[model samples]
Target: MDARFLGITELTEVPSVAVVIDVMRAYTVAAWAFGRGAEKIVLAESLDEVRALKAVHPDWVALKDGPPAEGFDAVNSPGLLRSADLGGRTVVQKTTAGTVGALAVKDASLVLCAGFVVAEATARVLRRRECDAVTFVVTGEDGRAEEDLACAQYIARRAAGEEVDAADHLRRAMESRAASELTEGVREGAHPDDVALCVELDRFPFAMVAAPDDSLMVLRPYAVPR
Candidate 1:
């Protein structure tokens, strides 16, 4: 069962467990949000949707996402997150790829947010659940980014019961970007600094569990508590 992989359009079903990945920045920001003690995070696919979510959850924080030039409330860059004043607030985030992917897989039995920043922790969470299926939803820029596929392969290798070689995985992932027809402008908007920040494996000691309300619940990195 773990050998299977699926790409989804909308998150409407729940599997026994699900692993959501927004590797470029969304998941990284999510982790940072928790680290800063934010109460929760509501993920939306579009800027309009995020604004609407914020309207109702006024106390909740809102992040607009898009290319840097377009200027979304929060750019999908990790460097920006590190400085954000999330001392005590909930953030509603929308991103080019990450958040939307998260919204797509809402139906999974359990959704655990992930990225290169939290890959090790995420994998540990998966082992603890021992679910019948684990889905990794990749968020791509304009619906296409080599990074997403690289992340998928990384997670897929882990799910396949193979050894996960971080260096090798990154190399493989980067190779696609090198060959991609996409432009530097689209890729650079994610920010090189942000990419570096997000790709630091096991940097955080926590895993984010998605709540019924689509917000996240922070859990210790190792496993779930009884």
Candidate 2:
């Protein structure tokens, strides 16, 4: 199996398997949500779609670009999801990169959303499946963010049976602008705890797989050995 790393811009070139990385917060939050027993997470490409979905399914939790709306369970923050009771509930998520990147790879034979939490499981799955080609989509803000790139690299190396230093990757991500926004409280609706949560590599022992449910893509957690 061969693995290739690319940013969200190169989502057109479909591979046998695709993994979308968003270490800053999106996939990190998703891991926490699944850890808390979330049934399924719906990935919405736009905030408008999130709202429309919420209108029909009021019980669904919605997390959009900015701060979460009033009465919503939580924002797109991993720390916030830590305290949420999402058991048996569906979450509607719309992010700048993660969800958008996941939706863009419709042609991929298999699609998975991941972060530091599920890096090992993702790598294990790829090797077990023996995919001919795998694409690691680093879903960053404008183009490629340090945190996402580092996560993608880590997964790629692990999938290729290489030794990865998790601490070094975390150190590099902490120095990134994306990490600084959460640490320095620069980005609106961002919490310092969220940054800390996102950097905890291999925190979860499950990988999120994307499956078609009617007209939407639902991310469902599949447990893997730690």
**Top-TM-score candidate index:** 2
Residue-by-residue lDDT tens digits, candidate 1, 29-137: 7887777677677666567766676677666776655555432356656677677777678777776666656656666667777776666666666655565566666
Which segments of model 2 are wrong by more than 4 Å?
70-72
Candidate 1 — what's its lDDT? Answer: 0.61
lDDT of 1 at 115: 70
Clashing pairs in 1: 11-104, 13-107, 13-108, 14-107, 14-108, 14-109, 15-108, 15-109, 61-90
Candidate models: Cα lDDT each: 0.61, 0.83
Candidate 1 Cα deviation (angstroms), residue 136: 2.2
Model 1: how far is 14 from its true place, Å?
A: 5.2
Root-mean-square deviation of every model: 4.2, 1.5
Give the range of the ten consecutive residues with the poorest summed lDDT in model 2: 64-73
Q: What is the lDDT for 27 in model 2?
A: 95
Q: Write the per-residue lDDT of candidate 2 for residues 1-226, one digit (tens) a residue.
A: 5777787786556777889888888899899989988899999978888888899999998886557676455788887678888889999998888898888885678998999888999888877877778888887864468888888888888888898788888877878889888887776677668888888888988889997789998899987654
